[model samples]
Target: MLIILILPLLKANHPDFMNMATKAVKRAFLVALIPLLLFLSESTTGFIHKLPWFDIFLTSLDMSYKLDIFPTVFLPVALFVTWNILEYSLWYMAQDPNQQKFIKYLLIFLLTMIILVTSGNLITLFLGWEGVGIMSFLLISWYFSRNDAVVAAMQAVLYNRIGDIGFLMAFCWLISYSGSISLDFALATTAKSTTLPLVGFILAAASKSAQFGLHPWLASAMEGPTPVSALLHSSTMVVAGIYLLIRTQPLLGLNDTALTTCLCLGAISTAFAATAALTQNDIKKIVAYSTSSQLGLMMVAIGLNLPHLAMFHICTHAFFKAMLFMCSGIIIHSLNDEQDIRKMGGLQHHLPLTTTCVSIGSLALMGTPFLAGFYSKDAIIEAMNTSYVNFTALLLTLIAVSFTAVYSLRLMYFTSLKYPRHNVIINFDELSTPVFKTITRLCLGSIFAGWLILHFFLPSNDITHTMPPHIKMTALLITLLAFIIAFDLAKFHWTKEPKNKITSKQFSTNFYPIIIHRSVTTLTMNFSWNLTSHILDLLLLKALMPDLLKITQLPPMLMVRLSQSGLIKLYISALLITLFLAMIPTILL
Candidate 1:
């Protein structure tokens, strides 16, 4: 584990060496994981006990870590990181001059997430949390020359700072009430003391996962390189919040208010983002909104007291979501960075394999039958239906699930099935060996990884939902109905009618979240400027400093004026006065 953390720093200044270092780190993680998986495959419990050094490492640092869940979560995360790195090298950053630096950043980002997932103590978790946040800012604003990229990076950082406030509040509360930073200790706290921190954790998770009101940054984050998008959305930064809630499920399960809050937020976000995605033209933003939507479903699972299902979804979502982004990258890169789907068409003929992989990813995302998403997503929906919680949240989630299908199909229609829309007559094909292989591996995982992990890795008891056949089939039914709607919608031309344009515009602009965020930000900045520049600097500091200075210098000015007077008697008298004062002190002594 230490080697995985430290290996990325070796010879990082040299680009060539850094490339090799990343490859070596990937191998090191695989080597470390193989043994853990072997042990886990034998027995989930007591596997950590067998590894004496693991305990010693934790003891040396004087920090607690969740050993059992760590390996399970880390397996998928490690695989995703490895695949993302491979994609980063092959297609996304192939032409970039500073690809090596990007690779190093990605490795460090992976390490921080590792730190976060394994953390049993709040301090360690915070360290990892802040590390990922900083790395995200760097990676998102990679195209420093681009104004949008920089603004997007700033937006992400600022929104996450709000989440951090909640995180810190939870940390302080845990330490104050429990007298220990250990998550295990927090779990044992009374309901009265734990409720506030649980709320804090939910707030933090909402912001980090882009739930509802805190979701604009997720869409804006598309300005970054696609690989960064893949990594951030798939397994690292955004999922950090979901993982936090998953790790603290025991506490959350005890708090009714917190769980309800989560359910509401998740339901609203899933619906909002899915609706917005239906109108978006940017390929990456569509996928970004899909991510937010999926994250909301995960939150819904947590809210329904099904955190293991949330973890299950996270693991499955990572594979196809990463593949989707990478497939989008291939298209965007091929088209000279054109992200507007409206300008793209008939890509299935031009790039068959890439389009096929994208179709597979989209299908998996929509929770089509037997795909990776089907297992986890279907389970979540079923659980929501059977849940005795808010019926409104369940309704919103079901609507969002249908909307998920609509948008996914709409995306496929525009990018794959429609007639050619671009003026460029360039030949598009999946000829790159590395790109083909990378996506192919993910494609296979999209097909079978969910079943493999569900049967072998995940605890079966946690995911078992005994719902009626009709309720269980609701997700599939809604998805199919959405497909028919999408087919009918696709029959029309790309241009919108007069009445529809306004609604489309709203959805495409993320229903004014971006506008609202910008307006609020501008108002805050203007208010701050007025307070500082006009009130403090101009009125208070400028107005008072001169008077204060004059008051301080009055006695000195009088003394100087007296000494410089033209009258000899005044000077002589001043000199005599000085000598008299000096003699008086000596006499007193």
Candidate 2:
């Protein structure tokens, strides 16, 4: 684990660090994949390998590093996909002056994820957890000069901190009640009374996973670079929450309240984010929102007591989601960072390979039959259907499923289909060999990784488990409806221009986004004005100044008057007069 973590950081200090870091990461991932692949090929699974790094006895309990099947399985996958992201970034950040620093940060980012996944105890896991959050802040603010990037970075950090509070609370509770921060102890000692700690875990997971109320950060995170988005959305930041839940599934099972909370929150986040993705025009933001939506689905699976299925989706999602982000990066760069999909069309002529990638990734995301997403996504929906949940939760999950297809197709239409929107004569510029090769490999995964993983870990027929006809057909019907909705929505939004020129102008100008932007700006300005008027003006100037002036001036004025009068005699006369007036009041009383 130490060697693997250090490999990426070896060249982090090099002058030509950007290029060197990419090579280092790719090699490290490939090297890491070898042992994992070998282990997977073995006939026996669920083997526990212990590599004890630290050992301490807290009274009778053992606090030490240990390795198991779960971390072993996830480590190589994270390494492999993270390497792919780095390789993809070689081309994406090729010309960036700060590419070296960006590459260094990304390498550090991967290390943190590795630490989190391979952690032997909750304490170690939190270290990795905090590391990932810090790296996210740094990477998201890569373009620190851009106000949007700065805000996005701050938002990301703040949301994660909210989640961190939960983690911290859970840690404290576990240490106090269980007397150990080790996973084994926590899992072994589970009871219904463990709900408090479980609730903390849920809160942490919900925020980190970008569920519902805490989800705004995911959409706004697009202010970062495309590579940052790809790395973040795919394997590292968002997945951390899901991973924590999966890691603590045993403890989660102890508390019915925690499980139900996960279910409701997941359902709401899934539906809400999917709907938001449909209306968003920015390509990266759409993908970003979809990450949150899919995260919701993962949460739903966990809530439904299908943590393995959630992990399956995470593995498969990493491939296509990363490819899609990279494709978006390609398109955005080619068009001089044009992010709005409405302004893009007929990219098949200029970017044939990239367009194909977008189609494959988007279709996979839609859970189209036989794609990578199909195996896990369909399984998740089926699991949700069979779970004991209320109608509202079920409906929300189903609606989110359909919206996935709707927005996926909508994205493809505005991005790769329709007539050419660009006036310039376009040419087919072949992508650099490294970029093309890296993307093609990821595309292959997007096509077949789920199928292969499912076949090996969960056979194809295992997912179908003797369900009724209606139950089996649920995914199909929802997908079909999604296609229809996407087609109509696209036609309405992109194909047919408004009849009245003024209305057309309004639509073309994207009035809703403008309204939202203005609303936020207006609110912010009003807040500033109120602060200035109330806190600065009313409290400091109007209320404080005259009183301060009277107090300071009165003493000096009295001294000046006494000095000017040369009046020892006058002062005595004034004192006597005051005394006589006081005596007269007492006498009258």
560: Cα error in model 2, Å:
34
TM-score of each candidate structure, all chains considered together: 0.85, 0.82
Clashes of each: 0, 0
> Which lDDT tens digits does candidate 1 get at residues 1-589?
6575465577688657555655666676566666567655676552322122233322323444566654455555555555445555545677789877887787788878877887767767888889999999999999989999999999999989999999999888887777665677767774643588888888899889999888899999999988899889988899999989987877888788888998999999899889888778899999999999999999998898788888889888988998899889888877877899988989887888989999999999999999999999998988887768788898999999999998898888888986878755655557677687778888988999788767755553554446678887999999999988887878865435455555545435454775787799899999998878888777788778986788898989998876786998987898999999989978998
Model 2 residue 257 distance off true place after TM-score fit, in angstroms: 1.4
Q: Which ten residues in a row have the lowest lDDT in candidate 2?
A: 504-513
Report the lDDT tens digits of candidate 2 across residue range 1-589.
5574575566566677666666666677677665566656773344323444554664333223444555555665676777777777777777888777787888889888877877767767888899999999999899899999998899888878888999999888777777766776766776665787777888898888899877777877888888899999999989999999988887786667888888899999999889888778899988988899999999988888778888889988998999899889888888877898988999987889999999999999989899999999998888777656878998998999899999899889988888877644553254787668878988998999888777545421234467787888798789888899789888786577657756535323234345655787899999999888788877798668987889888999998776567758887888899899989978998
Full-model lDDT, candidate 1: 0.81
